[model samples]
Target chain A: MAQKTIAGVNLEVTEDGYLENPSLWTEEIAKEIAKEEGIELTEKHFEVIKFIRENAEAGLTIRKVGKSGIVDIKGFYDLFPGGPLKISTKIAGIKKPASCV
Target chain B: MKKILILGAGTGGTIMANKLRKSLDREEWDITIVDKHKTHYYQPGFLFIPFGIYNKQDVIKPKANFIPAGVNLIYSDIDKVVAEENKVLLEGGKVLNYDFLIVATGTRVDPDETPGLKGELWHKEIFDFYTVEGALALQEYFETWKGGKLVMSIAELPFKCPVAPLEFVFLADEYFTKVGIRDKVDITYVTPLPGAFTKPKATKMLGALLEEKNIKVIPDFYLESVDNKEKKIKSYDGLEIPFDVLTIVPVNKGDDMVERSGMGDDLNFIPTDKHTLRSEKYENIFVLGDASNIPTSKAGSVVHFAAEVLFDNLLCAIKGRELRAKFDGHANCYIETGFGKGSLIDFNYETEPLPGTYPLPGIGPFGLLQNTKMNHYGKVIFRWIYWHMLLKGKELPVENHMSMAGKKKS
Candidate 1:
């Protein structure tokens, strides 16, 4: 665990830069994290992020997010650009999706 | 007499039947098992069939042969589990009520889920080794055909026997070389995972082996559809790879009955308690093996270890005691790396596969994460163990919970 300041809030984060405590996340923090990942936070992105944050406990997958009704898989790739699930979950203030062995 | 209904007489269900029947009296408890299929398949043997190492006869036996006497075996299709009524409706209008239920329906490959996967190329240029038909078909195809681009793609995540595809490629390397087509064959592994495997040390080790064998690894390629016209597979992210022969682990899902009963996730796996192995919704219903979304590899070893935990918990449930036995998602796999050499891995929910001796600290006949001939022998002899001991629920020397005694922290 490491401490990092995102949007003026000191928060604990994982080695891969995912938020350790999802509850500490704010919209400002998400935008700041998105900026670091070279993505501009759009309302549409936030909608997908909202879906991700809500369902993170249930387990998030690219297939699950594709069927989230907010976006198709192609649209998701366009929004996040690379490694959609990994990047989106980072910006969504959740831990990286496990490999689900 | 109270009834104990066990569904799907595969590895998990069969083990439960054997264990439960031995402990529970026949006069007080009626143990009944239901499965549509008559033949019990040694699923691990399927990996060898495509390479002509094992045949259909080697892997198959009558399901009734392993089922103990005094336990009822009903070979029929299950309609759905009416958990509320504690009864299951069979296809032929047979209603069986149960005091406790064991769900071990397992998982199956659904090629139809991916568009064009089940098209003209299916069972022709494309095959899956997960089934007897697919393995046999691939065997016939390999016998006549000259080698070209051979692509082994995993269509989805959390599929059964996570190491099987890696084993397939390793075996292919040896098989083709022996057939004098090693240079002509181009082997590529395509997977949705970011690397050759999920873990760090194991991935590094296996990735190096793949590199050494000249097999290409294509990571993070989430397959969307197969372009049958162009003989290419397209990813959801717009990447495409052409193939001469495509062997795929198609989308794996639990039995359709779980979906019909409204008790499964999107993949049809039951929502189960990872530790207790009980259904999240129904108290009397316990899930086992690949049928449950347990966040672990869906393999026979996992089923075997989990069956032990489930047996203890179910016994507790029957006696109106607290479910004390906890399954830690212990999974052990012997990876066939071809040419009479193999590797082994043992882990659980919290631990990743580490390098060391296994079952006995510093004195393993089988080495964990080390490619050796002894590990190959362990896998080779496992077929006998599976039939004679494992299905009978006879105690094996290995502990049900994963032990860290032998594994190195690094």
Candidate 2:
């Protein structure tokens, strides 16, 4: 149970640095997290972050996000290089989804 | 009773032992499986240990647990295979005469083949994720270490799980980012191949992924030796890469028994028929997995697909019929890109990895050459399937031969 204070807001995080509470997420928090991940807060990145935050409770994935027309699979990779869904979800302040190993 | 001797009770040998035990007449045909060790390792799971994704207990089980009741599991080191006399000699002078033989003694990481790979700093700064102990050692090393230049390289080609090194670097990126020090750690991938992977299309795709992750790829650099004192790796072409942590996939060679048997190529891999899986020099012996010099990626899936073809050919040979089964070198791998998603690649000897739906034509829960969370799930789920279904010789839905139905051409 680790705590991280991002964008002047305090929130609980896991050892892996994923947000523990989805409700604590704000647009400013997403921008700060994205900046730390070496990604600028562009409209495209915001589109993904918003989509993930909206569907955060249902457990959204890159595939489902791709099918939702927010972005294609390749665009998802372009948005988040190493891991699109995981990074996006983290920036959106959602709990880390399981089955990622 | 006629004995069917199977060497090495690993994945392929265990499957053959279980499959043949049911197929052959139990009263007349006797099956004997031999290995030096009692524990059977789920070798694919070794990739996840360094990142704390899988523990040792999850990947290991007793060899006798999976072997069928009818098969005799002998724990002994092999001395040599006297192929001419159809006999296998154990180290303590136990001779086994067999009507048929299956060589599944898989390849092992030979760090000694390199000049300075096993010197001082072995397992400290230099680590290989191939063996169980090495993977565990790396787990400890990765923890409590701050950030620096982290390098992952392959000492040579023909290594087991050809995609593992790539997966390792990708996982490193995700792991470092998760630990909040990805910015401090610089990751570089050094390989002897011209691209990120062996196949052309896969190279283009995976190479791009590496570039996207900001992981530098030093391709076409043949490893000459390790400079242990200087903490650097020197390539034969006069190139050198220095790193604070070097995770290397060492030069893989077949069993020492293969070398002693005088039936293997220069690297001690048995020269096997590409299509039939039969031993090139012996009529009654067949080679599978990493033990065979079959110009294919020596991954577990290749062995699983080859087992289907090999078992049919073995049955035909036993009945004195023409061997109709031909292995098309069908190999599939689930590449973990970390962060909960992965990509799947399905290709044979001829076709390169293409973008398409997999296991279905128009519809797929999994995508080929497309990174998705489902592919990650597929990779994780495979561990369960491998132990319960694959090793027990149960039939899976996937075809033995590579299919072009769902794939897009280039």
lDDT per prediction? 0.94, 0.87
For each candidate, what's the DockQ? 0.72, 0.01
Candidate 1 local accuracy as lDDT?
0.94
TM-score of each: 0.99, 0.80
Per-candidate iRMSD? 1.1, 14.1
True contacts kept of each: 0.53, 0.00
Q: After superposition, how far is residue A59 of candidate 1 from its true place, in Å?
A: 1.3
Clashing pairs in 1: none
Q: Please provide, for model 2 over B52-125, each residue's C-alpha lDDT reduced to its tens digit, 9 standing for 90 to 100.
A: 99999999999999998989999999999999999999989999999999999999999998889999999998
lDDT of 1 by residue, A1-101 (tens): 89999999999999889998999999999999999999999999999999999999888888889889999888999999869999999999998888857
Per residue, candidate 1 scores C-alpha lDDT tens digits across B296-345 of 89999999999989989999999999999999999999999999999999
What is the TM-score of candidate 1?
Answer: 0.99
Candidate 2 Cα misplacement greater than 4 A, ranges: A1-101
In candidate 2 chain B, what residue range of length 10 has the lowest lDDT sum?
A: B192-201
